[model samples]
Target: MAMAVLERFAVLSSPDLDEFRHSVSQFLTPHRLTPLAGNTAGVHTDLSKTSVGPVSLVYCRNSGVELGVHLTENVDYYDINLALHGRNRVTFGRDEVVVDASRAAVISPRMRVDMRLSDDYRQLHVRIERQALTDHLEAMLGRSAPAVIRFEPDMDLTGPAARGWLRTVRILLQDLDQPAGLAEHLLAAAPWANLLMTGLLLAQPNNYSPQLERIDAGLRQPTPVRRAMDVIECDPSADLSVDRLARAVRMTPRSLQRHFRSALGVSPHEYVQQVRLARVHEELRLAEPGTVTVTEVALRWGFTHVPRFAGLYRKRYGTPPSQTLRDAL
Candidate 1:
């Protein structure tokens, strides 16, 4: 529901270089832009942007000229740039990288960046809030990060995983084009935002890579099981699949399952079901009898099959779900 707070889409275009630069800065970050020495009377710039929760998808093209942009003070977000046409020479911190279709770049927050774009350059950029990403990292690490998380300037986008991430971005952009897009709904947008963030975290090499690798190896000081349990208890309605839970606590699925069984005498899946069942019971007891049904409550808590859900409800609550609803009424 928090995803519903922002406007969904916008488009901006201009033939005036200064106007275009100003518009782009308003949409993204503040930067000084200088047109390269092509004494042209007319240059065209087009920008399209879609905001889905904390993440923004932007596509921009500047034709018939080269340009240089300087961001002396780092912006408070991460920029993942994918050059779709032509190329860009990006200098961030001490490193410089050429970004094109095959090579992507992740620009960290608060880092000075100098970039030069070719005449026909077009790019698909994803901007994610630093706080949002840092929160996600903390959730994955099961603790606060010791320092600022920085990424390598260049990333190989031709790999299978990276390609998959690109496909997701393309789909998101396409969805945003519709008048009644799926992203307009909070439920759809929230998951899409999470997917993009999680995908970026996994795809890009960052400060947390070693810790993640350690998690995969089952060598961690903080207990992942406890963290996983805490997450489940805090938000049972979250999309807490085995993979997501495992990633949160920095463990392989097998490792997480083993730890859950060893500590709680139940698998993670079973624990989640139990928690959902309890939540369903609480909601049913509090519901106005005819206003809500058992099936609705069951589905809300992730139980899909009505007959099977009734059976489980009976087993857990010593009564049919309908009876619980009826009694509450």
Candidate 2:
């Protein structure tokens, strides 16, 4: 099966800074951030609250050749930056590095550094209370963080993980002005926060026992149904019988059926068919010339026997797959 690189999340962007500051102050002690020359940077208070901490997202955009940032004072909290677009030259402690799209970097508390961008760039900046992250770290590692971590931006660590983290951040960032309870929404972001931290911890290999525990605990979180859905999504053409899907998630067929029915109000077979048809419909919208045949696409998503597939397709979409592909052309 081809690995379709799915975009899991996006980052927050804004034109409002006052609201951003108020939201950030909920979690971190507010400090005046000196703006960088030749770039636009703003922090917006998202009215949402997460389980991990209060929500505030920052955006920095540089439209010219380069932008540089110098931290003069030692901060008492943890901060993370993800280059959403273009490139950056970062100097942290004794390390000097260049980071571009698909890469992320972190600066430890009290670590003064200089950051330079080589092209027009935008980045998502997240600041967390030092003690909150420290508690998580200590719980995972069984000790305190070494005074500092000198990070050299590496694509391997940042590419996939950073993309995933930013996608989730962007979602919460949107609820900032909806006249809703920001605190509850922000608190619910704990899972995302945990995932972000887990990715960072995995980035640097250290003997932190508590940190390991946290990651392990996250893995143990009940997600069998989600996992089963993912399997269905990955290869819709497979034999997705009730017993088979149940086995994939390590649950009994009866148990799985009961749980899915309770949660989604649909039978497993019906759900799988719906997913499979949806995939066919999507492909039909942009299917390439001749490469994706009506018969092939249908069979691929577990619709064996062209007549049955065609009948089902017509019933749901009011058009056949052949019509879809032809229109796409």
Candidate 3:
């Protein structure tokens, strides 16, 4: 079983940073930090208006080789780190990269990331909730974030405009002592941050290869297909005719059929029937005999035509639905 934990914190002092780090360590799997080679490390953090948004900022220090540090926690949020003063090295999923005062990094919570700070490094850290980042970025970029993104080892972060934006946001954060209730802070920051990040991403050469670009294009079109499948899966008892599905996806019936054939090499009506039969088979295999009738199971998944449904079910499953239901008892 997967364990999930969500923690919300507002820190305004040095002590708060200590407490927050402790909480984060405990929440993740047991992870320890040690000094890096030939360097000593120290950290200082101050928070201004923490309640303004889901933004949590911290300051970090390092002066040597830091080792054995692993972010083992599976977080469901967004962590964006801006290196203000020190160089940071990270190993995420076997891909190693180093970030410094010139560049920023964003890591999703579910992945593990290990950090090694340079002895002279100091930085500002920000963690935003995952959904907030995605929704905001998608709206601003007119696309979705890829499943994974790791900056290449030699990627540059020297763009003056990008650096200026980051500085301005940090200054704004430093000036606020509490959340202003005048407007939604997240809504206000979403565009600014997305635009800034978008520019940064585009500036990185080799960020999107031909294969990756093709995959990205495919993901955009798959939404309609996924939605049609969801409707069928959600209520298998309903009529899932191609005409209905086509209307649901805002396409003509012929177009829908063509799409399914091109994408999955199957007709839409056949797909629905296959799904319904599979659902009925599962229920028969797991359900108690007296609790449900084979005919009832068939009808529940849109098999109103009893004889035809049974004939097809037996041919596909190599047994009558009634026999499977009886065996479950």
Candidate 4:
């Protein structure tokens, strides 16, 4: 038997159409499901949900049955659906898309949706709330035009940004599935949730994509201070004490400390903490959720005391180290 996605949070389980309808109705509104086959005997179905931040990660699959879904009402969310294996069809009037492991179907809000799902169509549904997405876009563009948002019908999962997006999704789902996962604390989980939305907005094209592209192009790398900051950032997990940084930058320890404080308002030691904290954040986001821990990340960045590192991380990011191990899709 294949491992079920989101199996830790099963929300529905049924053998056929009637029970599936009844069980799923309470979960969604203004939608209907019908079996295309004359009979659905011996077919097994399962559904699960994990809500994080402003989005819901939903999983559903069937043993082997042709099913149709209709959404006629104006909905309030977007469902970016990806099948782990097999294929599914989605149509918006004349436009249509086929989604599988390398492609995704973005079901936008308020659109008339017609769907055909068959066989072992196991899928992970990234359900993001419509207005929250709109709000996030406004913040990203630094404007509040009071306009709604829409996206292209399909997403290519093969591109670099899209692949990163998928990895982030895996991180979010796999990490939260654990007993001591990032979902426990709002401080950690909420930002990660926002980050997931942000990644989707940036990765996939939308109405404001041109402007987003412009903004992305405008971003410049941070300038290093006397090349010492550059060396420290190159490998933040190194022994970046004042003496070491001074040697690298060709200055006495006292001179290096004074220069760092004068240029950045922090001593060499304090500056290293900022860089190491950022490295930890970067690593946590990219780390395989089930395999890496916050403690491991801190120690890797030369943080000897886990509690002190946690405090600094929380203060700097308004989130904890563990909560950051997820994002995207």
Task: Give the clashing residue pairs of candidate 4, or none.
Answer: none
Instruction: Flag regions of model 3 displaced more than 4 Å.
Output: 1-20, 23-31, 36-52, 62-68, 137-155, 159-171, 174-329
C-alpha lDDT of residue 310 in model 4: 93
**TM-score on alpha carbons, each prediction:** 0.64, 0.43, 0.44, 0.65
- Lowest lDDT 10-residue stretch of candidate 2: 1-10
- In candidate 2, position 12 carries an lDDT of 23
lDDT scores for all predictions?
Answer: 0.78, 0.58, 0.57, 0.76
As for TM-score, the candidate ahead, 1 or 2, is 1
Ranking by lDDT: 1, 4, 2, 3
On lDDT, who's better, 2 or 3?
A: 2
lDDT tens digits by residue: candidate 4, 92-193: 889998988788988777777788887777878888888788778766754432346788989999999888888888887777778778775777867877
Candidate 2 residue-wise lDDT at 79: 61
Q: Taking the tens digit of each residue's C-alpha lDDT, what string does model 2 give over 1-329?
A: 01111112222234454444444444444533333554444322122223335223455444434445555566566566656677777777677656555555665666766777644566556666655565566445422343343333443434565555566555545543234634246555676566556555655443453435443553454687767767776777789999999999999999878766655556778768877887777677668787788888887778888898888878877878788889999
What are the per-model numbers of colliding residue pairs?
1, 22, 12, 0
Could you tell me how far off, in angstroms, the CA of residue 83 lies in candidate 4 after the best superposition?
0.7
The alpha-carbon root-mean-square deviation between model 1 and the true structure, to one decimal in Å, is: 14.0
Give candidate 4 regions above 4 Å deviation: 1-3, 221-329
| Model 1: per-residue Cα lDDT at residue 311 | 87
Tens digit per residue, CA lDDT, model 1, 1-329: 01111224446667888887787887678888888976756678887776889998777788878989897567789899888788999987678889987898888887878999998788877999888887777566544443577888788888887788888887777677666888879888778988998888777888887765544443332477768978887887788899999999899999888887655556889778877877787678768847888888888888878888888778877888788778788
